[model samples]
Target: MLTPTVVSNSTVRRSSRTPAANARTSTRCSNCAMRHLCMPQGLTVDELPKLEALICNARSVRRGDFVYRAGDPFENLFVARSGSLKTVMAHRDGREQVTALRLAGDPLGLDGISTGMHTASAVALEDSSVCIIPYPALKHMCRETGAMQDRLHRLMSEQIIRESSQMMVLGSLSADERVAAFLLDVSERNGQRGYSHAEFNLRMTREDMGSYLGMTLETVSRTLSRFQKRGLIDAQGKLIRIIDLESLRRL
Candidate 1:
């Protein structure tokens, strides 16, 4: 399971942006790291310049900023350039359930496509920058370009696969198994984003973890303690070190 860390006040900072010196001119498009990820896989040089014009670099969000809330009109697809984000849904009874935790290089707000409104709230878990791809422009591109259509299909397919995995986790696994599976999943995703797979910081709280795993906060705590006692993981407050990855996988 992921452990929550109490970050010091000094680590938090507000999102800020300053005007670019060459704001009036179009910039070169070859250097963008998210080019292939945000757009189609095989965009031609002729198409890139137009795509660049539609994209705007935005300020980084601090750790508690809401990117967008549930019920907000969908405007853009946010591609995380750095740090992490948590997507949550709230119940009528006032309980919040964490739906997904996104890392750098993941796309946010895709769920808005079906309803034309955000289905969940997205909040930054750390200082993060997101490339805003306006939805109208993207829709136009997808209709006009075959490559964009293929990319959108691939993205939707990926979402389906993830949702299927989540259903299996929630419906079939025990509390301890769920926690173990979640940590391993997070570790693998973190590794994909160029961080250490087995060792990295966890930003979500125990309550949030419990919500995601469909368990009470106390059950979450008990499971973590049991894992620690069995030498599967070491927890010192929020800092957790995985000691038995194979055992965790077995659970």
Candidate 2:
């Protein structure tokens, strides 16, 4: 069982109880803003109640705190209800490598399903909240509803695709190409979630981005500067704007 922490104001405390245990109300899947991203598209009237009951808890994590650490026993999966987080794995030498960035509507802990233990730690990039979906209850619901089972399979497929893309980026791309690809990828993802794709704040620090892209911090900074100088992008601190989308796509 994973023990998730919740933040109230600036105070951090651990909790073993479900998130709904101390709450007045929980968001129902049918009415949630992120429903389109995580919920099954076609559900019968009978299935909606089961889906809502499956996600009875919601956790609030402060910035810099972990949602779940690597190696923790996996009891539930999570959906990012708001804000963002990064999943990282620790090396034998004690260095942590950033593996994936999770935005609002993204699923976390899918990597744990096979091993029954989390493979990476998920830390909040900013103050974030996640809707907790207990896997045992979810599996029971899946057995009862084919739509729910299909949704779970789709989430797993998406995780695999993201990992494959990262491998390709790290293995074949030059530093410049890698950075461009990263920016483009972020842009597309933001657009998918109904945010401004051309301009958005990149919450990840340059150092963290470097770790995820398999580049040095200096290399990441230098490449961004080069992109800005070439009029391909306008970057101010962590805010990035794609100035020439066509030109960036070609790179």
Candidate 3:
């Protein structure tokens, strides 16, 4: 069984120290901010020293960078520190689908755990930084640390559950329900990151949102317009402000 650890927000903040300083001080390890979400929930003082040494090399990627392309060899686990990313799948016919949109604190590339190769391409939707935890180093830590292994299992399980739920939502929900549920879901997730749940931005485009929601672009635009007219939401291009969260939930 995996034990859940509660990492303090402060500890997470401390992980984002610059690489230069992180190389010198085990106590002041870098990548804390990004690791907050992906790392074990709570870490003891003893564990921190070992973890800092294992996670020595780190890099930053800007918007539009391809973290990894589909079919690429996978060697590291990626954690989004800030901004958003989209995993896309392109067919031989030139059709493209936006499979997933990940925000700050979300982990990507775990879906390739079994295959050892990425199934979709991960690209930053905005200026972003990601912490790359090499698989060998991570595996070594997990083998030596019970808590670290537990955290890895929990993360993998969570990913499975989320993907399963998304499939169910796509299969069973009506168009209106899907759109409404998507808005509510995004709002709640954003809220977790300390942003206003009712008033925040939509980083993905309408077409991409429609693709994820299993609706056409026209339907997405029309539905959004209806929400605006009904005062359910206020959206201007990518900026969406949820005016009536309750009503959105009820829908």
Candidate topping lDDT: 2
Decoy 3 TM-score against native: 0.84
Q: For model 2, what is the C-alpha lDDT against the true structure?
A: 0.85
Better of 1 and 3 by lDDT: 1
Q: For model 3, what is the C-alpha lDDT against the true structure?
A: 0.75
Candidate 2 structure quality by residue, lDDT tens digits, 20-65:
4546475687777778899987889988987887674567778887
Model 3: CA > 4 A from native: 1-36, 56-58
Q: Per-residue lDDT tens digits of candidate 3, residues 98-142?
A: 888888778778866779887888887666666556677789989
TM-score of each: 0.83, 0.92, 0.84
Best candidate, TM-score-wise? Answer: 2
Per-model C-alpha RMSD: 6.2, 4.1, 8.2
Model 2 residue 215 distance off true place after TM-score fit, in angstroms: 0.2
Arranged by TM-score, best first: 2, 3, 1
Q: Where's the lowest-lDDT run of ten residues in candidate 1?
A: 7-16
Q: Please give the clash total of every predicted structure, in order.
A: 0, 0, 5
